[model samples]
Target chain A: MSEFDLIRKHLTGIGARRDDVVVDLGDDCAVLRVPHGRELAVSIDTLVAGVHFLPDCDAESLGWKSLAVGLSDLAATGAEPAWATLALTLPAADEAWLAAFCRGFAELAAAQDVRLVGGDLTRGPLTISVQVHGFVPAGHALRRAGARPGDLVCVSGALGDAGLALRHLQRGEPLDDYLRRRLERPVPRVELGELLRGLASAAIDLSDGLVADLGHILAASGCAAWVELDRLPLADQVAGVVAGQAAGGADWGLPLASGDDYELCFTLPPEHAAELSVLAAAARCPITRIGEVVPGSGLRLLTSDGHPWAGTVAGYDHFHG
Target chain B: MSEFDLIRKHLTGIGARRDDVVVDLGDDCAVLRVPHGRELAVSIDTLVAGVHFLPDCDAESLGWKSLAVGLSDLAATGAEPAWATLALTLPAADEAWLAAFCRGFAELAAAQDVRLVGGDLTRGPLTISVQVHGFVPAGHALRRAGARPGDLVCVSGALGDAGLALRHLQRGEPLDDYLRRRLERPVPRVELGELLRGLASAAIDLSDGLVADLGHILAASGCAAWVELDRLPLADQVAGVVAGQAAGGADWGLPLASGDDYELCFTLPPEHAAELSVLAAAARCPITRIGEVVPGSGLRLLTSDGHPWAGTVAGYDHFHG
Candidate 1:
C-alpha cells in the first residue's frame, strides 16, 4: 500500500532497453540522447475520470486513450515517435485496475517503440497526464501556419464516430463494435504523418471536431477552407445511431461537429495529391479529400453542388461540456 | 465557460519566447530546436491536493512548488534549465485562483528562463503535473549509478524547514513567514547542478527525506554511506518551533525523515570537494558535507562523537501515510 509498490509492480521494466535512455524509470530524471540533427516535438494531455470519459469506463480503454491523445499531437506535427511519461493519480491502488491499465499501455508503447522513461504516481481523484516526446529533422516539422490557399484539405479516417458513440452511450442506445472501438481505442496516425512529411503543408489532429480544429488551422495559417459536406467519411454505424434518435436520419452535420476522432486533418498542394494517394495506399489508411484551401479567413461548409451550405457545425468545448 | 476561453484568458501568450522554440503554446505540439550534440533530460512530477499539499494551501505557493518539483529533477541530472509543460486540473474555474496561481508560476518560470511551451487544462480534483525538459552533453548527465566508494556526499541548502512548517501547520501552532516560505517556495538548485556537471558522480533531489532519497543513490551505486548527523544544516528558526512542541525541543531526527525539502543531495570525488566551495559561492547555493561513501551497502547514520546512531527516520509513504 504505497506509491513505490504500485509503480514497481506495474510500471518498472516496461521501457524497452535502449542505449539512448541513459537513465530510466526509477531515476530523478531520465536522460535521452536526442539524435544529433533532429528537433524535438513535445505535447501534454490530461484525462479526468468523469470529465474526459465515463467514470465506469474500462481501465484498459482509459489507458489506451490516455497515451493515444498525446501521440495524436505527434502525428499532427509529423514527428517520429520516441518516448513518453505518464502521471497517474488514483483514489486507491487496486491491483487489478493497475494491471489492466498497464497491459493496455504497454501494448501501445511496444507497438510505437516509445520508451517509458519516467513518470509519477499519486493518490487522488482519477486522472492521467501523459507527455509524449518525438523527433523530426530540423526545419521539416509540419506546422499549422504552413497551409497555402491552393492546398487540398484531407482527412485520414472517418469522423464523428467517437462523438456519436458518446451520444449513443449516454442515451442508452446499444453500440456496435466499430462505434465502441472508435470511442474506446481511437488510433493515432503517426506513420501516415511521417509519410506526409514533405507532402502536407499544414496538419492538425481532430480531437475537438472538424469545425473548431480546422478553424484553428485557418486562424493560424491566415486562410480559408471550403469543406464539401458530401465528402465527409462518416462512421459506418453513426447513421444507424442517428436514425434511432428523434433527430431523424443521417445527421450530415454531426460528422463536422463531433470530437475525439483523433484523425489527422491536413492540407497539401494539389500537385502532391497524387503522391498522397500512393502513400495512403501504402499506409493502408483511408485518406479522403474533404475540402480545399482558399483565400481569406473562416471555415466554409459547401454543398455537393458547389453552393454555400449553412448548418450548425461546432466542436465540443471542454469547459462547456 | 469554454475550454478555449479558459486557456486564452489564463494560459496563452504566457510563453517566454526563445530561438529554439519553433512552435510555442498555441500549437498542437511544441517544437524545440534541440541544440546539436546535446542530449535531452526529461522528468515528470505530479502534486495532488491533500497528499502533496494541503487542500487549502495558497494558490500562489502551489503554483510555484508545482514547477519547482519537476525542476528539482533536472537539477539532480545536472541538466541546464530549458522548457516545461504544465497539466493543471481543477474542480472549478475561479478567476482569482487562476490569476494568483499563474502569478507564482510565471515568476519562477522567468527566473529559470524555461519557456512555458505547452500544457493541458482539465476539470477534476486539484492536481498539477509538470514535465520538464533540459539539455546535457552526450554521456555527461549525472546518474544515481555513478557514486563510487570514497566519494564525499554533499547537500545544497538547509533541510527540515518545510517539514517543520508542515508539522506546525498540522499541529495548529503559530506560523512564521520563514518556515512557510521554505515550504512554499523552496528553490531548485538548477545552476548549482550545472556547475557540478563533471564534478559530481551521483545526484538526487531530497523529496522523500535524506534517509530514503540517499538510500536510492546508495542502492543504485552499490556503495554505502555514513552520514554524520551533526553536520545536517537545519533551519535557524526550526529550533524555536520545536521548542514550542510538547514532546521535545529541536528534534534532530526531523531533518532526516521529513520530506518536501526540495534540496539536491549529491556525491563527488573527494578531490573535487575544494572546487565545490568556489562553485557554491558563485552560485549562492550553500553546499554542506554531511557524509561519505563506503564499500559496503546501506546508510549508516553516525553520532557527532563517532558512535553508531540508531533512530527511527522513515519518510512519507503515499499509501501508508
Candidate 2:
C-alpha cells in the first residue's frame, strides 16, 4: 500500500475527537486551541524494539506502552492531555499488527480524551515516538524544584511490579497474571497528578526507579529525603520476593532501583499531608506517605529501626546500562 | 555515560530561549504559555537511517535536515515556530558526532527562534523524530482544503535540486556544490509561509514531490489543476540537466516527481497572484506562478504549445519506492 493509503486504512479516525483540535490527521500540521488561562505542557518519548521492549513482544501491548510512557510525563506535570502525535517506524506494513496496535493506542487515548492529531510513518527497524500535549492551569504546574524541607514525601500506587515482571519474563519463569499485566500495561497517574496540582510541592513520575526518581526531586529542590524502606508499598509478588531474600541482599534493591514503575513520587507540606485520605479517594488510588524531606542534599534510606539501609541503588541508563 | 548525563552534556542549554517557556529541559514536561488569540500548530516527522537518509551521512547535516523536515510542515500552515521536541534513537553515544549534530540542530533552531523544549533519548539503530509546535492566529492557519477552481497555483523557490543531488550521490557521480548544499541544508519557507496566510487559498510543503504533494491539495480541495510544465521554476543545475536530455525524457521526471524539495506550494486568487512581486520581495525568495486550479479531478500537464506532455511522475514513498 502507499503511505497515504496505509494511514487512511489503519491509523486514522481511531482516537478521541476533541473540539479543541481545530485541524487533525490529514493536514500537514494539526492546529489546536489551548483553552484560555491554561498553559501547554508537552513531552516526548521513544521506544525501540529489543532495547525498550522485547523484539517479539505483542504489538498491541507495545502500542499501549508507547503512548503510556509519554502520558506519564504529562501526568507528572499535572497536565490534562489533549493531543498526541506518533512517529512510527516499522520494517514493513503488517496489516494485522497495525490494527492491533491502533486498537491498543485508541483505548488509552479515549480514556484520557487525547486526539491523535498528526504523525509520520516510515520504513525502518521498529520504533515508536509519541509526543503528548496537555493543558494545565496557569501557574499551577507541578514541578520538581518546589519541595521544601520538613515536607512529607509520598507516592501513589505500588512500586517494583513492572520491574519484577521484567525479571520473570527475562528468566522465562512463570508469573501471575497480575504481574504480566503490570509489565505490559502501565497506567499513567493522570487523575492523581491533577489532584496534586495545588497540594503537592514537588512531583515526578517514577520511571527510572524510586531512588533515582526521588533523587531528581531532591536535586532539583536542593533538599535531602529519608525513605523508610519498610513503608514502601510493594506489589504483592514483589513483597513475597523481598521476604524470601536475606536482609540487605541485592534483592532488597528491587523496590528501590528497578525501573518502569510509572507511579507518582511527590512531596507536600505537613498540613496538606493530613488530607491524604480525601485526595486518595478523589484520585481512586492509594496514597502512601513513605518519607520526609530534609534540609540537606541527596536521598537516604532508613530501615524500620531508623538506621541507614545499605543496598545497591542504580537508575536504568539506556546508554551505559 | 548515563542517559541523563548524555542529555546534560550534549543536548542541554542550546537553541532559542523564549519568554513563553515556563519550564523547559530538566522538567517532567515543558510548560509554555501560548499567547491568547493563537492556535497551536503541531507536526511530527521521523528520519530513519537508510530510509529517510543515508546511514553514513554527515551528522551535522542529518541533524539540520531532521528539524527542517518538521519545520517545513509548520511553514505550510503559516505558523510561527515556537518549540521543538526531539526523540533521538542512536546505536551508541558518540560524543563527537553528538556535538556536531547538536550544533547543526541549534543553528536552524536559533534562526527560526524555536526553543528546544523537551525530548527523550534512547538506544537503538539511528532514528530521529522531531515534533515541532508553532502558533498561528486563530482562524488564520493555512490549510489544504480551501482552494477554488479559479485560484492560481504558485510555488516558492526552485525545485529538483535536492532530488538530483540524491541521484548523483547514489550513482557516485560528480555534482555541483550548490546541489550538494541544497540536498544538505533545505531552508523551510517560514517567512514566505507566514506572508501567504491571508492571501493563499491553500498551502502544502513539497516533500513527497510536486505531483504527489499537489495531488493532496487537489484531493482535499476537490479540484484539479493544469500545470504549464515549462513554467516550473527549476534550479540552475536542474535546468542544465534537463537541457542535456531529450524531450519528455526521465530528466523531466526529475523536476516533477523527485522528492525532498521542502518548498512551499500554494494557491491564491488571481487578484492576490498579481501581488506576487511584492510578496516575493518581502519573503526574500522567488515566487513562481506555474499553473491554475480548475474544476474536475486529477492534475493535467501541458507543454508550452498546449500539447499534453506525459512522462513518469511517481512520488517518493518510503514503503513502496
Candidate 3:
C-alpha cells in the first residue's frame, strides 16, 4: 500500500510540456503565455467516488476519466487542448495506485499534447477535480446558443455504450471488455470540435444523455428538435441486449437517457451538413445526423419512420443518485 | 436542504462580469478573451475537511478562504485578478451551509473584482477546489527563479497569526478576534504583488511558513538567504502564545515554521529596497525586511544581533500531518 501525497512522485512525469508554460510545477501558480489572438477556454469537472464512478473503480481508469471529463468540455468549445491542473483528494495514498493512476492520466495528456503544469494533492474522501485550459481563436468558440431552427442536429460516434455499461455495473453483472472500456475510458472529441469551429453552429459534449444534453442546446438557442430515435448510433451491446429483452425496454431510450458518453453533439446548417461525412471519414470516427432543429420549445422524439414517440426516462442527476 | 447542484442557483449571481468573459457560467466551458500582450497566471488549491481545515469550521469562512488561497497565488506572480472557478464536493447539500458558503465566497470574488465562471459540483467528501485565472504581461510575472545575490528579502503583512490560531483551535483554547480572523480570512496581497512586479526580482506566497516557503525561492533562484529572525513582523498573539509559554518556547520559531500566513515574500535589489517604506505607506499594508540573498544554498537564520540561529521545526507538511 502507498501512503503519501499523490502528486509527489507519480504525476511529476505526466503530460507534454509546452513552450508557452513559463512556470511549471513546484510554484504557487503556473504562468502561461496565451498565444496572441487566442481566447482561453476553461472548464472544471469533479468525479466523486460513488456519485460519478463506482466506489471500487480502478484507480487508473478514474485518473484517466477525470482528465477526460475536463478535456471533453474543451472539445465542446472548439478549443485546442493545452494545459491542465488537477486537484486530487484521496483517503490514502497507495504506491501502486499512484503509479497506475499516473500512467492512465499521462497517456491521455500525451495524446492530447497537453501539459500538466500544476496541481494540489490532499487527504479527504476520494474526489478528483480537473480544470482544463485550452485556447481557441477569438470569437470562434462553439457554443450552445448559436443553433438555428433550420440546423441539422448531429452526434459524433456511438452513444449508448457507456450508459449500457453503467447498467451492467449497477446490476453487478460482469462487463465485457468492450463495454468496460467504453465506460471506463470515454473518448473526448477534440479534433472533431476543432474541425467544426466555423462549420458547426452549435456544439456540446454528451455527458448527460442525448435528450437532456440536447435539450440544453434547444433551450439556449431558443428552438426545438425532431429527433429520429432509430437514427441514434447505439452501441452493439445496447442494441442487442435491450432491443427486445423486456416490454417497453427503452431500446432507444438507452441513447436518449444514457449519460457519460463524452461524445460531441453538434448542429450545422443544411449546406454544410453533408460535409460531416467527409470529415468523419478523415477522423476515423462515425458522425451521425439524428435530428432537425425546429422553431419551438423542447424536443420531440420520433420513430424510425417519423412517427411520434414518448419516453419517461430522465437524465443523470447526482442528487437522485 | 439544498438538494440540487450548488452551481445552478447560487453561484450565478455571485461575482461581477468582465468584458473579457465572452461566455460565463452555464456552458460546457467558459470562454475568456485574454487581452493582447497579457499572459495567464493559473493556480489551483483544494481545502479538505479535517485536513486543510477543521472538520466543523464555519461554512462561510471555508468558502471565503477557498477563493483567497487561489488568489494568493495570483498575488505571488503579480497578476491582476480576473476570473475564478470552483469545484466543490460535499456529502450532502444543506441550503443553510450553501447560502453561508456562497455569501463568504461571493464577497471575496466581488472585492477582488474576479468573475466566477464555470464549476462542477458532486457528492462525496467535503472538499472545495478553487482555480484562479489572472493576467500579467508576457515575461513580467515575478517568479522564484529571479533572485540574485545581494538582494533584500521582504514580506507583506504580518505572519504566524494563522498558525497560532490553528494551535489555539487544536488545543481547545478560545481565540481572540484578531487571532480568529487571521485564521479564517487571509487577505491576498494582490495590490502589493502588482506593485512589486517590476521592482521585486523574485517572489512567493507564504503558505508553508517562512523557512520552507522562502526555501522554495532559494532553491529555484540557486541562491541562499540569510533571514533575521528578530526582524520578522509577528502578530501579537503568536509571539505571546509561543514565547516562553512552554519549556524552550521560541520567541521566533513559531513564525519561522508556521504556515498559512498567505503573505507575499519577495526580494529586490538593495537600491530599490528603501522604496518599500514608501510603497508600504501607499498600499497601507506592512512590508518588512526580514532577510537578504546570499551566495550559497539553503536558508540561514540569525537572531536580531546577527548571531547564528537553530531550530528543529519544519514547515507544514501535508504528509506529516
Candidate 4:
C-alpha cells in the first residue's frame, strides 16, 4: 500500500471532534473555528534525536515528551489546550513503533483534552515536531511584558529534578521511582497558570534552565532579577544527590541551568504574595517566590550572605560548543 | 555566537508585528488575537534535506518553498493569510545562509501580509518545518467534503510544471528561464482560492500529483470523477518538454501524478461554471474545467476518443517502492 493508504488505514484513528474541525486528517489542511471571544495560542517544538533526547530513548517516552514539551508552552501563556498537529519523520514506518508511539501520544493528549487535528508523517532520521494550539479569552492572556520592577519572581514546583534525572540516566544509575518518573513525565503547570493569569505579571516556562529561561522574562520586560540561591525549591532527590557528591562545590548549577524543567516562572507584586499563597494552597501545587524583579538589565544571583553567588552560567545552546 | 543569539540578533527581524502579537519570538509560546468573526486555519509542512528538495537547493528558494507550501493549504481553505512560525534545524548555523533564508521567508510572508509570530532554531540535520495560521469568516471556509455529485471539477493555471521542473533539475537539463523559475518559485493561487471560496463546493490545493490530490476530494465527497485528458491546462514550457520527449506516452503521466503544483483544484456546481469563469477572468487566473463529479467511487481518465488511459502514478510518496 502507498503511504497515503497506510496513513488513512492505520493512523487516522486518533480522535478529534469532527464538528468544529471542518477538515480532518486526510485533507491537505485542517480548518478549525475558534469560538468568539477566544484567541488562539500556537507553539511549535521540534525534538531531534541525539539532541533533544537519547537516540535509544523509548519510543513511548519520545512521543509523550513531544506533546509535553509543546503543552508546556501553552501552559506558560495560560491558554487552555485545544488542538495539536504532529509532524513525524522516521527512518521507516515500523508498525510496532508507530503503535506504541501513538498510544503514548494519545494518552497524554487525552489527559490534557487536546485533540490530534492533523499532521504529516514522513521518512527521515527520527524527528518529532508538534505544533499545539490553545484558546484564551481576549485581553486575558498572560504575557512577559507585564512584569514590574518590584514584582516577586515565582516558580511552580521543584527545579533541578529533571536535570538531575538526565545525569542519573547518563550515569546509568538506577534512580528511585520518584526521580525516574520526574524525568519521564514532567507535569506542566497548566491549571496553575490559568489561576494566575490575571494575577501574575510576566510569565515564561523553564525549558532552557532557570537562569536562561528567566532571562527571557527580564529581557522582554526590560527589568532585572535578583534570585536568592538558597531559596530555590530543589527536589528532595536532587538535594540528596548534591549532598552525596564529593567536594565539587556548587554542582547544583545543572539544576539552575539545566533545561527541560517544564515549570512556569512568573512575577507578581509583593502585595499579591499572600493571595498567591492562598491560590497555591487551593491548587495544592508548590509556588515558590525565589526572588524579586529589580530595575536593571541583567540577572544577579544572591547568596544567603547578601553577596553575589557566582556559578557557571552554562546552559543548552543550540549551536555552540 | 549560538543559534539562539543569531536568531535573536538577525532572524528575528522578519517583519514581525510585535504590537498585536502577545508573545513574539524568544518565548515558549506566541499568543495572538483572532478577530471576532474569523475562524483560524492552521497547517504544517516539513521539508527534509534529501526528501523534499534537492540537497543543494538555494537557501532562499528552500525558505520560500517551505512557506509557500504551508500557505497553499491556507489558500485552499480561503483563509486570509495571517501568521507563520518556522522551526529551522541546521547542522550548523551559517550566517550567510541564515541571512538569505530569512530574506526569502520574510519576502513571501510580507507579500501575503502574514506576520512572523514565533518559532525555534535548533541544531540537527537540515530540516525546515513551517506552521501557518490564517483567518476566514465564520461558516465561510471551503472544505474537501463539500463536493456534490454533478459538480464541475476545475483547476487553476497549469499543472505538472513543478514536477517537470524537478525532473529537469535532476537530469541537469538546460531549460529556458521559465521552467527554471517554476522550479525555484511556485506562485500559489492564493487569491484565486479566496475568490472561489463561496463558489467552489469542495476545494484543495494541488501539492501532490493532480490525480492523487484530487482523489482526496473524491474520497471525502464520496463521488467519482471523469477527467478529460485533452482539456488539461499545461504551461507552455511543460508542453515544450512533452513535445521534446521521444515518446509522449510515459511523459503524459508526469503532469497527472507528479506533485508540487501548488495550484488550486476545486469543484463547482454546473450552474456556477459560467459565474466561475467570470470570476476566474476577474482574478486574472485561468480556471480549466478538466473533469466532472459523478455518483460513484473511482476516478477515470478519458481521452478524446473516450478510451481509458492507463498511466503510472508519479507523485511523491513517503513509503512505497
Pick the DockQ winner: 2
Q: Write candidate 2's Cα lDDT for B148-172 as tens digits.
A: 9999999988989898999899998
Encode model 3's per-residue lDDT on A9-96: one tens digit a residue.
7766579979999988767788898888889999988888888898889988877898899999999999999999988887776668
Query: Candidate 2 has which clashing residue pairs, if any?
Result: none
CA shift at B166, candidate 2, in angstroms?
Answer: 1.2
Ranking of all predicted structures according to DockQ, beginning with the best and ending with the worst = 2, 1, 4, 3
Worst 10 residues of 1 chain A by lDDT: A241-250
CA lDDT of B308 in candidate 1?
83
The total of clashing pairs for model 1 equals 0
TM for candidate 3 is 0.95
Q: List the residue pairs that clash in candidate 4.
A: none
TM-score of chain A of each: 0.95, 0.98, 0.96, 0.95
Per-candidate total of colliding backbone pairs: 0, 0, 3, 0
Q: Residues B174-219, candidate 1, lDDT per residue (tens digit)?
A: 7788888889998999988888889999999999899888998999
Q: For candidate 1, list the clashing residue pairs, or say none.
A: none
Residues B65-156 of candidate 3 have per-residue lDDT tens digits of 99999999999999999999998887777768878998899999999999999877777788899999999988899898889999999998
The residue-level lDDT of candidate 4 at B179 comes to 69
Give the range where candidate 2 chain B is weakest over 10 consecutive residues by summed lDDT.
B246-255
Candidate 1 residue-wise lDDT at A118: 82
Lowest lDDT block of 10, candidate 2 chain A: A246-255
